[model samples]
Target: MSKANKESLSVGTKIEYRKDFKDIYLPKTMPVIIDVPKMKYVMISGEGDPNGEEFARVSEALFSLSYAVKMSYKSNEVPAGYYEYTVFPLEGIWDLVDKSKPATDKSNLKYTIMIRQPDFLTDELFDRFVKRTKKKKQNPYLEKLTFGEIAEGLCCQIMHVGSFDDEPESFARMEAFCEEEGYVRSDYTHREIYLSDPRKTEVTKLNTVLRFAVRRFR
Candidate 1:
């Protein structure tokens, strides 16, 4: 972990990533470049339409583990560096299984859905919580969970508000912005941080942070 992140965890105050790292999680509507720090996450990979039953199961498994860590204070063994904080929102890195397939083909999509973990969560602690959650929750997807870190060095991002299908419009604006700034998207894949729950929120009101790696135009 970076010194700043380590310090944030050791302070014992509630660390809300949304409030602290708003630039990354809650970006402005217009595209901008930012350096995303490395952070640990509990992730599950699967290929299929995100709206399918299997996707829901994978998402549930991630939340089950995240909540276990959040509510660990009530448990007999609190984590070594436990602190009060809201659970991070669900995020996904999306791609297509077949390059020839268009983005509109949901069934051809591949994704790794994940929820970010607090800085204090260690590899050993993650395993303990996973084991504990497995016993408490009967979700088979829990076994597929893996813990790791991701560092998106420099990226262009924008706050996309509206239906998921309308994302291409936002991406077009982002790509245009990159071109104006002498940068270009580094890959076809992109990351989305879902700030609104589709189950409770209206499609037009959904807030998603759309981001992709970028490099200076060579």
Candidate 2:
């Protein structure tokens, strides 16, 4: 089982392959954790299904938008220091997008939308994200763009069950499982490729893929 798949089931959850995201820049592929300021998006955050409309909007942005993405090596954080977003061999990132309102109270109000780093964004990329947000006028935030280095190597990951609120318990279990198997965390940041939008999904059915970069200790 792959790191992501194995982790998903260990916590009693199911994860399906969305698709194979690839690019022509194969060997030069860079992973980045970004600091995207609260910016607006075309699809508004709602309840019951984040993947409902907002995802379509973003899908259009990443795969449909004519703009290119940015790439870098390190967390978007200032000074770039964190132990949670460094999972490699899978391209981990600490994405920070500032949303008008957080999906949950625990989310960083000033910073929202955390995803993988070293994106393939070009100059007009963020401009497009903003354009999408302009579709809604109720509340506004920016998607600030910052870059981080792309850590490399093999990784083990899992898709978590339940709400973002339930991450702690799953994390604990996953940690123990990895450790028992003789795998050690690289102190890389804990990362989640959020599939279900917290705003639009039920707390019980949320989908978050958690991944940690593991390497054999020398």
The candidate that achieves the highest lDDT relative to the unseen native structure: 1
| TM-score of every model versus the real structure | 0.93, 0.42
Q: Over 4 Å off in model 1, which ranges?
A: 1-12
lDDT of model number 1: 0.92
Best by TM-score: 1
lDDT of 1 at 49: 96
The local distance difference test score of each candidate is 0.92, 0.40
Give the Cα-based TM-score of candidate 1 against the true structure. 0.93
Q: Which stretches of candidate 2 lie over 4 Å from their true place?
A: 1-17, 21-143, 147-149
Lowest lDDT sum, 10 consecutive residues, model 2, at: 21-30
* Tens digit per residue, CA lDDT, model 1, 1-218: 34564455557667787788899888989999998889899999999999999999999999999999998766666677778899999999999999897999999999999999988899999999999999999999999999999998899999999999999999999999999999999988999999999999999999999999999995
Residue-level lDDT of model 2, residues 1-218, one tens digit each, is 34654333245322122422311112111231222223222211222333345433433333222122221122131111111122111112332244454434433322123333223333344455445544632222233233232443555555676866676676676667667766677754555565665568988887666655676553
